[model samples]
Target chain A: MSAGMPFYVSPEQLMKDRADFARKGIARGRAVVVLQYDGGVAFVAENPSRALHKVSEIYDRIAFAAVGKYPEFENLRVAGVRYADLRGYSYDRSDVTARGLANAYAQTLGTVFTQESKPYEVELVVAEVGDTADGDQIYRLTYDGSVGDEHGYVAMGGGAEQIDAGLQQDWRPGMHLADALALAVRQLGADPAGGEPRTLTGDQLEVAVLDRNRPRRRFRRVQGELLTRLLSSEDPTADVPVPDEDDSPRASSTNPQTQRDSERDQDRDVDGGADA
Target chain B: MTAGPESGRLPSAYLVPGSSSFTEFLSAHAPALLPSRRPLPPQATLDAPHGTTIVTVTFRGGVVMAGDRRATMGNIIANRDMEKVFATDEYSLVGIAGTAGLAIELVRLFQVELEHYEKIEGTLMSLEGKANRLASMIRGNLGMAMQGLAVVPMFAGYDLIEDRGRIFSYDVTGGCYEEHDHHSVGSGSLFARGAMKKLYRRDQAAGDAVRVAVEALYDAADDDSATGGPDVGRRIWPTVGVVDAEGARFVTDDEVAGVVEAVIADRRDNPGGAR
Candidate 1:
């Protein structure tokens, strides 16, 4: 065929094509939910791999959750950590904020979308637990670097629309940790094709939180018996131990070996009170 | 990862998938930021403040580390209340004794190093791994150490794997030596170690550990002019840190003061400390 006179594709068409490709890639992954509770922010992801994490702590009070290709989002996660650490080192510990990190991620994602060959197929939520409930902030960044300042709750990845709808129907302000976690799991199990919801156990889900009651570094992972108890108990909050100010129990009160064995059994209960 | 256009985007080095080490990243991207990279005058015997007398004693469940509040410049006291003890992370503590300014800067870098690794890898470094990382950091400072500026730090932590408290000491050349029971570093380390040898007991409680550390510092101050004893008049006390299954925390001043008063009162009875 004679070289077709170079047909020009408009900028808008090219951008739309990239966006569609990225969205489709992201939608193939499992869902992640982030919501604000009475004490702090809770992150629940339908991730079964203990070694590979979908949620991580970025700074003193900031956390990150993402859904998409693991390697791609992992790159962004590491980059976010570097930015926060470098900034905190250069300035003060309090200087690192989720908004600043979200802005940096936006810049990187936006640049890559416009400049690189393939856009990153990742959607991220950056949450910071503030001093008060009203002060909590969550920023959602999409493939094209657009930001949404969401309040209360956010869901992303495959079946996100359905999960978001479920969260909207049930999520309320200042729910207990157990109620919040149950709501997230229920929503994550919602079927996109309008089928019956699947039940997710503690092993099948990954959970963590930015506990406002914690002293400086507020991020803590919830797993093992604590996760099961939170999922099964009717009054989980009644006996749920808030992590001490130091993030661990008093050294003199418990035996080291026993503490370690219990912690191993429970995985990581950030509240530091699961065994108690 | 090249030096691309000057834009608001993150440097390629930060985005590149690579090692979890923060210092390594800083070295590759901003070599000037590393404490060991600063160029010093060759063969220069610079007069700088030197912190003295850091002691670490293992209790039943954890470790207690304490440092006297003095930084000396030759015959003069450069700083009366220099903090030489720092909680490196939740489960670890570090006490520095060397060039005061450089040592503090090294501690800061080491703190960031551990924190960066934890955040990147989603787990705390093994106690041995942390000690090795600190060793390499000190090795980097060998360049400055050879020029009469050195940083010697005592590292103590509650090892989850080992299920007990552990201590690690380092030399000027970054040789990491695991010390059992108790250890000390600084200008007055000799005297402090002697006192600890007498007072440190196996399976001591946390309160006993604090007492032993303070007593060790007191004995060091009595013999070494560089070390400072508890200053009751100014209400200045030695900084104490405890690391155990619960994590690391600094002992409150009031608590340290109570110990200091008791030690001083006991010293009034015997010129020399307990045998």
Candidate 2:
């Protein structure tokens, strides 16, 4: 719309401008977690509502999630559900995989961020379970719509780095649902003595999983006393020493401190798939 | 093919904020996706499996609606214990009398449309808005209905604000008409309604309502071949649910078993099924 501007701009400049705008908006809100567990993934967010939910089934296998500005993300959620349903209706349900859905969201979010005046101030995660037990995959998409492939665990939100650091030593394979859920909660929970003063309940929190026992429908909200019971009952066997107080780094938009923060494990786990 | 999201070009309906009715949105965007868009071959009378009688009785807290499980296709009985009725939405249920496939599709789409509206707008549509939306959906399928496939579904749901249960009936043209007191629809509707007339009480409780429904369905099956009674051999019974102030909750298998057992006993003692 502006005159005197060249018809085309460099892809680098375009991408840079879009990313900056998206990062600013997203940094303003809390984050959500998409934990890839042994059987499937669980999306846990510290939302306080029995009726309103952050996690919902987009389809049989696919799910839609957001952490900031509910109205904006909710619209995306509905759209994602529509897209998924239509895709499944048109083609086979299996082909409507999580990766494909993430790509679609990336395309739409990236397009809006780059072309529209205001970018969506939300972050999303699209996860899929593979054939074998260990073939689960989680794709974390940032505000700028840039997609990141995550292994074992992926964290988002403002204080993501702190939690990621918290998970650095504790997260490991063969961790049961209880361990994974408790670890996730502790990572995101308010500190013993901290700045925020808000009490959360089992009903306030939302949890769901792509369970091995359950048939096609993997998305279910674990609510009220049930979730609270599960969270409190988890045995804290591998509680990592709180991120060494001295080494704790602030979370940035790009580096919301995923467990990969420690370079040692990054090479081993991130590339552990290369051998396979 | 329906005009799905893949087509970047949305119908004019997408741009404007129209009525809260999601069925209207579908009508404008892609009518083909709606159940009534399909064309059907004309016929004098369809001897297909006609779903059996539904009974809705208003009670103290709310209302309970139930139907017998039988679908008779001409001289030969077809699909004994077929569930002809279902809860269309959270607070509402639909019972079909015509083609099962089309009716099921209509019910499923109605569910999706409601969900879509709720997602787009944080709140659920009013009971009236929901009823109207279902009507429009029925209208969309008028094309197929004219040929021979007509679906008349009985809808019942609770109205939280009003603190009552509302049941609705529809014609082949998608005309929605609210039913008062007790109502029944299907081939055995006459017999079912007669039974409901005798059994129904204005302030019936949850249990009494279930018994009334069972009695009505029994009468329908006794007179009409299209209506099926509880099958002890197959362990199949009428799928029933209650619509009260809380919400529309289906009767569990165990609970249905209890009610059907009672109905079987009463029949054994008094074959007429009346006190």
Candidate 3:
């Protein structure tokens, strides 16, 4: 007996079908924002899990961020770390670069997209900050293995177009970390020009940065009381004065209703569709 | 995994759950790439230059480690400016004694090893953990040790957990022993250790501890021909490192030179060193 004849799918149709499949798969995940601040590059992702990370350090200066399927992006992140460590060991530490890592991921994703029946549903960003503001670099790699060098700001995942448009209006070349983080959170929290905006608290957001001011290692996470203070400090309606340098819990707990009122006010402000 | 385009996409080793140790990872993926994996001829004793005399001492708040600048091959001085002491990390110092080439390579590998662990685990290795990792690295070089090209390193670090300084000394066969108070290794170690025993005090200040280390090194240089004294003419002094609760810091040459001058002036009078 002979096996059934394979269905003849046209090359054009096959390529289109794969592209649509990958896009739809990625469109299901939440968005991530990567931008260049005065100090270095920063990453903001909408993730609730404290254990699972969307942003991670790949080397001393380079950082990796991703959005889409958790397992797929997580595997890519681990592989990037392994690659960077091996290269640094075999050569010098200065030899490891984000460009090389981006190209490597492109090769891997390109192979899986063309050769395999199902493509990897993941989007990645590899960023490295040089000693100066002009030296910062950010690379965005798509599910189909296309890599693009982004300038001041780049957004990925669902509703990226609207977020990018919002970032385009507010992003500056040399904003401070606090201002830049505020801009990112505002853009991530609000929708386009006129739409209902979502309220994302510090607990729902994951943020990190590749700070050039740091020594050899640049990547560091921003979370806990620091994140809350950064967000609340910028919001005018929060009505809560900036916490002391100690960042004691007593200050935040002193006025639970005040904090909730501020959050609820933000919800109403976004729901009202008031443009920035 | 070193799986180039020619090898499909990734090496089979990439799929396997590898060890957290970078050395073990290298051994599993590419054995020949490892420094200790290489073999030497049996019964052959190489005549490579060997560095000498590393000493470490724990004082009130922290520790001091210093090494003489000398390397010898047979009866001839191979190098006069060999740097035997290296800052392994932010809080740790390593001083090498034994085969010069292998020792330097080992130090570099150990640095990478610590960094690799920190990156993988997102935490700094403890002082004891760092010492044990180094001991295993030296153990991996057993093949070369048997060929008379041994590498014995003295490790010292500020223990974050214990809130004090600690020292660990290793033998050629990879035996790691925690040295209390102070310890020394290499050709001139005996003299250096003797000088330390006489001058060391449990309540010595940071500057006093440094003075004691310089005194011990001067004694080593005086007794052992392989060890070198401070080179006032060339402005080359023994490399001195201090590790406190703050972190590991190198004593600037200017500062060390000041102390050397003071020591030289005191030696003019007593010749027997400060009691």
* Candidate closest to the true structure, highest TM-score: 1
**What digit string (tens of lDDT, one per residue) describes model 1 on residues B1-275?**
22236665677778899899999988887788788999987778899999999999999999999999999999999888777887787788889999988887787788888889988987889999999999999999999999999999999999999889999999999999999999999999999999999999999999999999999999999999999999989998998989988887778788999999999989896968676
Error of 2 at A14 (Å): 3.4
| Best lDDT among the predictions, by candidate number | 1
Return the TM-score for candidate 2, rounded to 2 decimals: 0.73
Q: Which 10-residue window of candidate 1 chain B scores lowest in summed lDDT?
A: B1-10
lDDT of 2 by residue, A120-216 (tens): 8788887776644577768888776789888877777667777677777688876777688877777777553466744445665677765543434
Q: All predictions: root-mean-square deviation over Cα?
A: 6.6, 11.6, 11.7
Report fnat for all candidates as fractions from 0 to 1: 0.36, 0.02, 0.04
Deviation in angstroms for B218 in model 2? 1.6
Higher TM-score: candidate 1 or 2? 1
TM-score value, chain A, candidate 1: 0.86
RMSD of 1: 6.6
Q: What range of 10 consecutive residues in model 3 chain B has the weakest lDDT sum?
A: B7-16
User: Candidate 1, A184: how far from true, in Å?
Assistant: 1.7
Q: Is candidate 1 or candidate 3 better by lDDT?
A: 1
The docking category that best describes candidate 2 is incorrect
Per the 3 Å backbone cut-off, how many clashing residue pairs does candidate 2 have? 4
Error of 1 at B28 (Å): 0.5
Stronger candidate by DockQ (2 vs 3): 3
Chain B TM-score of candidate 2 stands at 0.88
